[model samples]
Structures are given as C-alpha cells and as structure tokens.
Target: MIQRIQTIYLLIASIVSGGLIFVFNLWKTLKEQIFVLDLFEEGLFTLNVVPFMFITSSILSLVTIFLYKNRKLQFVIGRIIILMNLFLLGLLIYLSLTLSGETIVSEKGIGMFLPILVVLLIVLANKAIKKDEDLVKSVDRLR
Candidate 1:
C-alpha cells in the first residue's frame, strides 16, 4: 500500500540520518583528545547538535510509522508532530545563527547544507504521508 511505501521511505531516511549522527558523535569523542583535522577546531562544539537532531528525527520517524500503521483513517497527530519538528528545527537554526554571529560567510557549506537536507527529508516524508492519506480517502469514497 502507499502508506507502507511511505513508511518504508521514512524509516530508511531516519536510519541513514541517525546513523550518520551516531558515527559523527562517536568520531568526535574518539578524537577529542587527539590533535587531528584542523577542521575540527573550528566550531567543534556545534558538532554536538548533529547527534541530537538525528536521534530525535529517527525516533519521530519510527513513531509516525507505527501511528500510521494502527490508524484506519487519516490522523491529525502526524501533522502536529511534523509541525513540532519544524518548530524544533527552526529553533535549532536560530540558536546556531545567534551563536555563530553575523558573518557574511558562504551559506552553501556542508554545515549549512546538512540542516537543510534534514529539513527537506522530513518535509518529503510528510508529503508522502499526505499522499497516502489522499489515496485512502479516494478509495473510501468509491466504497
């Protein structure tokens, strides 16, 4: 079913994103004591944000899948969750920008791109869920 497909896509995205975060965190901790990449020196504290976002995203994605599976009809709860996620993301970005200061630096860098990618992935997942609901509604109307 369309719902199942959407759920699967969400699951994969969550797992991949979460795995990346876990790995990044692990690496940070492991190399914290060692003088490694100079890249780590700049804004290393910001790296802490990555794991939290990914883990939260993963948990939300899993919860959404389970909720969809059990609900026979479209539920507003999923949309609420998605909205809350967007709010949380916005807060994180605001915090980052405030802390990073007013620099006209390039916004196309990986640090900027990562958060944008995560937001895009979640938005797409939400769209897929909406599509599934629309399909169910169409089928219900025929029956």
Candidate 2:
C-alpha cells in the first residue's frame, strides 16, 4: 500500500509544500530579501497568512498519504487539498497586487507558483485513488 503511485505523489506534494518553502523567497523588496520578517515587525496579527496556509496544506498532504485503507476518504481529502491550494493561489495573487503598491513595480517570487504545483499533484493523487477504487469495485463484482 505504501508503495503505491499515489503515495509517491503525496510524498512529493508534502516535500514541495514543506521542504521547498524555505528555499524560495516569497517576494523581494527594494530594501531587502524576503524571510525578512519585516511584515511582522509592525506587530500585525493578520500578516503571514500565506506561510500558514502552506504549512496546513503540507500537513494535510502527509495525513492523506496514510489513509490508503480508505480510498473514498483519501479521494475526498485530495479534493480538499486542491481547494485549499486554489484558495492559497488566489490569496497570493491578491497580496502580490496589493504589495506592489500603486506603481505596480515590485518583483514577484517563484514561491507564488508553489500552490499551483501542489494543486496539480493533488489532482494526480485523486485520479490514482479513483482508479484504485474502481479496481476494488470491479474485483468485488467478480465475487
């Protein structure tokens, strides 16, 4: 079960979300690079929503990997991860627009694209899960 293709997809998704997160900068300012924590230096609670979502998505992907015994549930969780990534992508776009200022002259980072990749990975996992479910149903019909 652990050796299934969907497990590999989920593992890669988790690695992308959890591991690659820190390797890339979210965005850069004229004054400094990201991971600067300047957004939080002002002591605002509403900041850092993107990083939080990323961590949540990573955890969900990891959890989904272990639910191989329940294909239906695993498929549902995969859908949830897709929706989460979509939401994260939307939020990232919005924030980038706002952060660019009225002149729209800030550099966007590659990290923003991570959500799209995650969504793709989750969809592949869901597809594999569905295929597994269909196989099980076919075998049951044979009996």
Candidate 3:
C-alpha cells in the first residue's frame, strides 16, 4: 500500500496544501503587508473560508494516503479534494479580480496558484489509484 506511486503523489499534495501555505504569501496589500490564508487581517473576513478549505484538503490528502486498502473510496476522496482545490482557486481569482487596482489587495502571490498544482498532483494520484483498482478487478475476474 505505502509502496504504491500514489503514496508519493499524495505526500507531495499534503506538503503543498499544508506546509507551503506558511511559506507562500497569498497577496500583498498596499501597505506592503504580505498575507497568507491564516494570517489575514480583519478586512479579509469574506475570504476566511480559504484557510479552512486548505486545512481540510491537506488533512484529506493525508487520510487518503492511509486508506490504501480501499481504492474506490480513495479515488472518490481524491475527486473531492480536486473539486475543493478548484473551488479555492476560483475563489482566489474572483477575490483578486474584484479587489483589483491596488485598493486593498494587489499583486497576487504564487500561493494563489498552488491550488492548480495540488489539483494536478491529486489527478495523477487518482489515475494511479484507478489503474490499481482496474488491475485488481481484472485479477479477480480470472478466478
């Protein structure tokens, strides 16, 4: 289970969703204050869901890594994570666009793009999991 290629992909996703957020700033304000999901000020109240989603996705990725015995469930969870990340990406984009022109938030950071990367990694992991599931089904049919 741990030896599977999906394990590696999930691990990387965990790092991106959990660890990288602290290191990467989400956006810069006019006062030169860099903000991350968790470090946002009071004015960023509307975007509070960002932190919760990131943490949830990170935890889900880790949980999926251990449920290697259930490939179908793992694949489903992967799909959930992908959708969550895509929603996060869209939210970030919409917020950035609405706040355009350096009024409050300006110059989006690399962190805004991290969801795309996580989505890609999760997709690859899901593909691998699906491949494993298909191989198992094929073997079971031989019996």
Candidate 4:
C-alpha cells in the first residue's frame, strides 16, 4: 500500500501544497516600492483564502494516500483535491487581474503555480489508483 506509485504521488502533492507554499512568494507589487506577497501576507481579501485552500488540499492529499486499500474512494478524494486546486487557481488569477491603481502587480511568483502542480500530481495519483482498481478487478475475474 505505502509502496504504491499513487502513494508517492499523493505524498509529493501534500508536500507541495503544505511545504513549498511558504518558500515562494505569490506576486510582486510595484507601488512606488517593489515587494513580494507570500501566502500568509494579506493582499486582497480573496487572496487570504489561498493559504487555507493550500492547507486543506495538503490535508486531503495525505488522507487520500492512507485510503489506498479503497482505491475507488482514494480516486474520488483525488478528484476533490483537483477541484479544490482549480478553485484556488481561479482565485489567484482573479487576484492578479483585479489589482488596481498605484499598486500594479509587476510579476507573478512561482508559488502562484503551486496549485497547478498539486492538481497535476493529484491527477497522476488518481490515474494510478484507477489502474490498481482495474488490475484488482481483472484478477478477480480470473479467479
């Protein structure tokens, strides 16, 4: 179970959502002075939700990894995590686009893309889980 490729994928997804988010800034603002905004720092009210979403996604990934025996459930949870990441990605895009007035967002940070990475990892994990399920079903048919 723990040795499965899906487990590894889920673990990496958790790490990306939980650990890497703090290491990178989300965006830079050029309002007389240039400064970076990490997930915790408040920019837009909606942007504040990003950190919470990341934490939730990380927890969900960890939970899904442990549900390896139930491949169908694991796959379902992975889909939920993917949707969560998609929501976060949309919010990030909204924040970047709506930045107004003196504070023009000069650049988007690598952290802004973390959700996309998480989504990709979750998708891979789900694919692996599906493969495992199919294998189990085929083995049952042989018996």
Per-residue alpha-carbon lDDT of candidate 3 for residues 40-65, written as tens digits (9 for 90 to 100)? 44456657888888889999999999
The candidate maximizing TM-score is: 3
lDDT for each candidate structure: 0.51, 0.82, 0.88, 0.83
The 10-residue segment of model 1 with minimum total lDDT is: 27-36
The residue-by-residue lDDT of candidate 2 on 26-108, one tens digit each, is: 68777655641334453444356666778888999999999999999999999998998899899878877776444635677
Model 4, 47-123: lDDT tens per residue? 66877898999999999888877888888889999999999999988877776662444777788899999999998
Best by lDDT: 3
For candidate 3, what is the total of clashing residue pairs? 0
TM-score order of candidates, top first:
3, 2, 4, 1
Q: Which TM-score value belongs to model 2?
A: 0.90
Name the lDDT value of residue 59 in candidate 2: 97
Output the TM-score of candidate 1.
0.54
Q: How much is the lDDT of residue 124 in candidate 4?
A: 91
For every candidate in turn, the CA RMSD to the true structure comes to 6.9, 2.2, 2.0, 2.7
TM-scores of the candidates are 0.54, 0.90, 0.90, 0.88
Worst 10 residues of 3 by lDDT: 33-42
Q: Where does candidate 4 have its weakest 10-residue lDDT segment? A: 31-40
